[model samples]
Target: MSPEFYTISQVADILSVSKETLRRWDNNGTLIPERDDGNNYRLYHKSQLEQFEQAQLLFQSNWNDELNIKASRPYKMLELFAGAGGLALGMEKAGLESVLLNELDKHACNTLRENRPDWNVVEGDISNIDFSEYHNEIDVLTGGFPCQAFSYAGKKLGFEDTRGTLFFEFARAVKETNPKVFLAENVRGLLNHEDGRTLETICDVIDDLGYKLVNPRVLKAIFYQVPQKRERLFLVGIRKDLISNSEFDWPSPYHRIMTMKDALKAGELYDCDVPNSEGQKYPKRKAEILAKVPQGGYWRDLPDDLQREYMMKSYFLGGGKTGMARRLSWDEPSLTLTCSPAQKQTERCHPEETRPLTVREYARIQTFPDNWKFSGPISAQYKQIGNAVPVNLAFAVGRSIIKTLNIIEKNTAMNKKKCA
Candidate 1:
């Protein structure tokens, strides 16, 4: 059963807004939270949220009905930066077939091949690869290219101006393949990177390449049944000539938010408890100190003397370093997972244990399947999982993309019949 009152974070996850946005709304009296009598926590009632369109769709969603989505035909996908096959797995689950995948990391490549021996996993730098042979052959081209700044010369940036960046390689692939559709995934920070000029340049490049882009939308992973509060920005594009035949729709939210309990324990998300696995350990002193901090608590919850001891000279620093010494709660979604869980500024201690989250626990939080084994050393495994788009989140997006592709496919069939 879920709680009646919503925390600021829960509301943010449901409405897909930032906590700061909720605070701004509070100040403006658009939506206000009643203070809890026990702890003075700001709590929003469901009645306060009834006016929101996002809230309405979430509460009234037919998620089970939507799960029946199936591709009209076998849609072939070619992907770049295919780390640990997270997106590929999701695409497969959504009934898409993979013809090729390229990645620079040998460990991630090994992981992919280990799990899917049939996939054509190309292990090398993407810049050296030629995509022209697959021109007009691929149904979709996808890449979660790293974000890098393009030098501005005081003029509107063009496609060539983005040279020397990984994004350029992605654009090069799109130019060569000429797929019906393409998806470019990036971190949410890309929206405001370099005063938003970076994304502006990307948009301009897509337009120059003769593709009509859907307005980029940032999808919150938690909204799509991922039990962690991870967010990814997705840019979907249609080859301009094909844009009129089909419409692209973003995936809908699940009926309810999933909690950490749903992730690690046996329940709706998984059929069994997370198996034991290797994880980072805290120093003796750190472990003792962390034991005192309750679940869901952070550095500020420690005793004052211990706080000074733990924080050292940094104790007097301004602003809430809320993530430090943080412990997760079973009842709420996790903070975003990173490449390392034991990092001092972003501790991800287990709910019932004092140590950092195990590699498998990290995988579970990312919605990777229980049987989907990760290859490489422990650190490499963590890196692969951390950098991945959640498998379930990717599946949701893949289904929506398939919906548009089915329409385009039917139109093409009709056109061919007329020509015959």
Candidate 2:
């Protein structure tokens, strides 16, 4: 059986507050519960808490204990454009504390706040927020800022050239915070975006801001324990000053790649098969057409007349159009999940059923914990899950950050000793 009672320290740790604060709240009747053996020891009975609405919610939804995963030291981070807290939660699991997180989406913000009450979530446009408050305090800064092209004013695009784009805010935050390191993650398309000039300009801006950009690499998530064929371009930077004695290493790939079966079934990923949950339904005729496609097959597998019927005007268009009517295979990693599973251009059909993937399946592919509830309508939840960085990928990156921070701390301590 689960423990019948919790210690003062346990409750404080779960709520991410202090024992003194809990005692004060208990004394004031703000969170009053029964007393222990003596009146001096204030104890909360688990049964009585069921009646208190707020306490009940706290009892059910807390994740603070999971936050205390192994780490050499607590490193602080300031994240920009944090979506659904995927990267933040992953980093937290890897022992980095999210001192502040900024996200513009209200629904995503609600998801973060509902899960972590103490987190300082700034829910608004990044342009309006100032990073000066975090200056010199944050050990690292990170953002998956959207890619946009800036009109080049000269041979080198200065900070002014990127003023209107979201990347400028990311650069501005890095410049202002002057952290020991920062990481920028983007879609793989960025490497070739704008005939590659856009990425070149971004690198120039980062270099101009006085950071050493590592040879940016596209890390495939399938190599990192994420059960989806997702690829992201990771641009890691270290403040020029910190690069002398330390080398930053990206997380090593897991020994084995996880397949779609590993994601949705009850095996390595979870103890039980996915819980039945709501999922998108294909149109009746579309479902019938897709049902004919074998596992791992797409629209091309359909009969010629059905393909012509489904393809419509697009049948005459050039290129493969491979995403149409695709069915995932149990043994293969899923093709990158799209925002709308039912979209014709990018269908991720269920391997067995002709329906789109269920919400739980989507979360599993993204490596979100089963109990980590999202907040919103079904569509909103799908969008949030689809847009997020896979939590395991984030955790892998977080471990690298901790490793780098450890090196920085050691070097700093050595310098101090020499001065002393």
State in Å the error of residue 259, model 1.
0.9
Clashes of 2: 0
Q: lDDT per residue, candidate 2, 296-397, as tens digits?
A: 789889899999999998888997888888998886678898887889999999899889999889999999988777888889889999999999999888
lDDT (C-alpha, whole model) for all candidates:
0.91, 0.83
lDDT of 1 by residue, 132-240 (tens): 9999999999889998999998989988889899999999999999999998899999999999999999999999999999999999888889999888999999999
Query: Which residues of candidate 2, in runs, are more than 4 Å off?
Result: 1-70
By lDDT, who's the top model here? Answer: 1
Question: Which candidate has the highest TM-score of all?
Answer: 1
Model 1 global lDDT (CA atoms, 0 to 1): 0.91
